[model samples]
Target: MDFLSWYDWITPTNPFASLFFGVIFTVIIGITVWIDTKKLKTTTLAMIVGVFVTIFGVTILNFIGFYN
Candidate 1:
């Protein structure tokens, strides 16, 4: 009946772990970008680069059977 108990279910062995972290990171980045009005362009460009890097990194990891 508590949040920690529910969070305990999302372990490294769980299939949703990667997805959960990915969503969490995306949300964090979104919030940072939303709050910084002065450097929005630079921040967004950096986020785009980060996204591409993550995509390629995950694809490479999966291709090499890192998950298995």
Candidate 2:
């Protein structure tokens, strides 16, 4: 599929989906910012690893048509 079509297909349209997506991003940002401010090297590293893991897991699920 083309980029636009894929984007349109994946983009959240329902209110719950939008809220969930927003909450996820907000949490990620909040965690990263909090860790940065605290200067906790181990937690920062763990968060980075976790974020990457989550991204890869979501990407795999998307490719497997789980979202559909």
Candidate 3:
């Protein structure tokens, strides 16, 4: 399957995969927010960090076939 096909499966067609990815995404976001809070003490900054970290992390995982 190509990237868009895989994206469709994980995003909507498969509930299990969606939930699994959601949990991993949430965990990544939570960790980034926690670490950023320690340094910046700013919710907005922490949220930004979390979003970027999660996006990059998921992209890397997908590239490595972890999400396939």
Top TM-score prediction, candidate number:
1
Every candidate's lDDT? 0.58, 0.56, 0.56
Which is superior by lDDT, 1 or 3?
1
Q: Which ten residues in a row have the lowest lDDT in candidate 3?
A: 9-18
Shift of residue 24 alpha carbon in model 3, Å: 9.6
Candidate 1 CA-lDDT value: 0.58
- Give the runs in model 1 whose Cα sits over 4 Å from its true position: 1-20, 33-37
Model 2 lDDT, full chain set: 0.56
For model 1, how does the per-residue alpha-carbon lDDT over 1-68 read when each residue is reduced to its tens digit? 22233453344323245444555676578668768754877677756766666566666766777656
TM-score of each: 0.54, 0.46, 0.43
Counting clashing residue pairs in each candidate, in order, gives 0, 0, 0
Clashes of 2: 0
> Candidate 3 residues 1-68, lDDT tens each?
33234565445333345444655566666667667666545645655665566567666666676654
